[model samples]
Target: MEAVLYAQERSKETRATLNSLRENGNIPAILYGKNVSNVPISVEKLDFKKQFNEIGKNGIFTIDVDGKRQQAIVRNYEVDPITREIIHIDFLAVNSLSVITADVRIVLVNDAEGVKDGGVLQQSMFDLSVTTNVNRFPDAIEVDVTHLQVGETITVGKIRQQYPFEINHENDEVIASILPPRQEEEISTGEEQEPGIPENLEGREE
Candidate 1:
């Protein structure tokens, strides 16, 4: 799906002017890419929401500034803590041949064999940094958990072989693991980490 956004170039970068832009229902953003400095612009909130819902964050979209169109990807965005509204967004211009570095999700498919046997499933890693041509990178990576047994694990080094992109993670980093069922009298349990193979991950920033 193709999505396009039309934005007006912003010249007044003062705080007061930016606040006024937001008050008028526009989202202030910047355009950045290789050999390109940040270019400030603003977009109508309603138009942005409509197109964003169609193409999603990772998909490529066209940003038209005063009739000049540039292909770009959503690099990052910020939300207002008080009202939970989108405040600022950063866009990175991209080409189809570019090898983009982005976060792709990891999902477990099929009920684990261990989970069927009263074992717990621990998903420590939810997303991974992957490097691949923009056309090849997937929205997510699905891992088969049909055969995982108690005390078994799937690690970064092990799972990357099943995909096209290179997973930028340490070899021993655990992705998913099956743990033995918890025993009775396990205190300090409510609203906490899982009992066995507790989710342990020092997630990286994309």
Candidate 2:
């Protein structure tokens, strides 16, 4: 999906200017491209929010700058710890002719057979890193764990057949595992020993 984002060229790169831009509700960002030149830009907070919310991070979108359009991906961003608002963003313009490496959301779906048998389900990886063409990148990778059993593990090699992209990890790498239910053991106490008193040794010396 593509999002319509409008950006402006940053006139200055000083802290004071950045602060004033923030006061005006604009965010500082940079756009890096392999084919296009890297440039510093600023975008309105409300405009960015509207596009971000619709396409989401990691989704390929088009950024329109001065009537020029560039296909890019939201590489990274910084958020305020307290306000949870986006502060800065970094974008990378993708070349449709080359393959790019990216992480795709990995979701474990369906009830595991081992879970009903008192087994605990554990996911080792939350995202699957893969290399694929820009237009071929998937939104997310879903894995079915309905056949997973206790003490059994699902490896990357097992689900490779379900995807077209090349996974950038070892085949034997573990993805998810089902652990047996934890056992409860009763605590056993040893016989208590009598406390030694200092006066007891003095009586023997007398």
Candidate 3:
């Protein structure tokens, strides 16, 4: 889960300089953390994307700037709205003993018994916020719904028993549920009124 990314120090923060870096296939980024000074740098976009795909957001890796390497994690990033390309990135320097807060994607595993019986499956939460050591961070949390029946729900309290990390949510918070067929039909059948011209104006035009 750990890999090294090479970067160069960026001396200028001007718009023109950032644009030039992007044109040269580099992504403008900043590295900072507790007790560490913020350093402006740029990394090769292709290399970054390759490493990012291997190590998810919660994975810890090393960033080599100039000749010095630091252990870091992906803190944040900005993407181009039009091109859907990453434009900027924020890296946080961390150590093995550091406890960081990260969002882990929630994955539903197995087919719910309710779904096999024609019940509609609804997921309320897509991810979970948790605080854990850098080495203990999980890429995603999987919840098994194989036995879930209609009218039943999976809650945060139920998931806590399976993982050791601290989840930053209330125990009673619902994650996923199954609705009965009747309720699903009612929700789908509630149609909105369509807009139409008035009868008096139907025969007239400007």
Candidate 4:
């Protein structure tokens, strides 16, 4: 929940972030805050890489811009889709206690039992949208499926949490389920294979 600080960009002199930052071996970015004006700046790519690695996408870093530091969060980051190199970035000024809505990953636990018992474990939701104070966001929600038998389902209401936020999904919505495995052999036996392929091949002279 710690917040990062950023430097104010003073001049608009810099253009062509790719070429300038490459020739100078730096990354170009702009910093703006709700309370502060936009400023253009650049930082060493290596240094940015180090900080990003330490904190990951959820991390906050103090960006030094022309010596005047202000509160900021990574609003957006531009990366090369193919090479995934950092290209451009936009920083937004953030307050420490602001409420934010974000997507949190949903993880399923003890799911292999379903597959072992001729049941299929179907995960219908990957990420769940949640609203919470910025500092108290949950990393993920873990659902225990060890006791879930075939035809049983786990819904959003079944998840219990009293910390920092609330789940946005409906109570009746199925997060995951254990369904009876499809009986391919039984289903195939119900249908007769058409005689088209065999009928065509039998008359081929080649």
The local lDDT score (0 to 100) that residue 153 gets in candidate 4 is: 87
What is every candidate's alpha-carbon RMSD to the true fold? 14.6, 3.7, 6.9, 5.4
Quote each prediction's TM-score.
0.84, 0.85, 0.87, 0.71
- Poorly placed runs, candidate 2 (over 4 Å): 187-206
Q: On a 0 to 100 scale, what is the lDDT of residue 68 in model 1?
A: 87
Native-to-model Cα distance after best TM-score fit, residue 61 in candidate 1, in Å:
1.4
Residue-by-residue lDDT tens digits, candidate 1, 52-91? 8777667787899999888888899999999999988898
Give the Å error, residue 71, model 3.
Answer: 0.6
- TM-score-best of 2 and 4: 2
Q: Where is model 3 more than 4 Å wrong at Cα?
A: 182-206
Best by TM-score: 3
lDDT of 4 by residue, 79-168 (tens): 879978887778765568766676778889865676778999999998888877655666677788888888888888877453346788
Order of all candidates by TM-score, from best down to worst?
3, 2, 1, 4
Counting clashing residue pairs in each candidate, in order, gives 0, 0, 0, 2
**Evaluated with lDDT, which candidate comes out highest?**
3
Instruction: Write the residue-wise lDDT of candidate 3 on 16-87 in tens digits.
Output: 999999999999999999988999999999999988989887887799999999999999999999999999
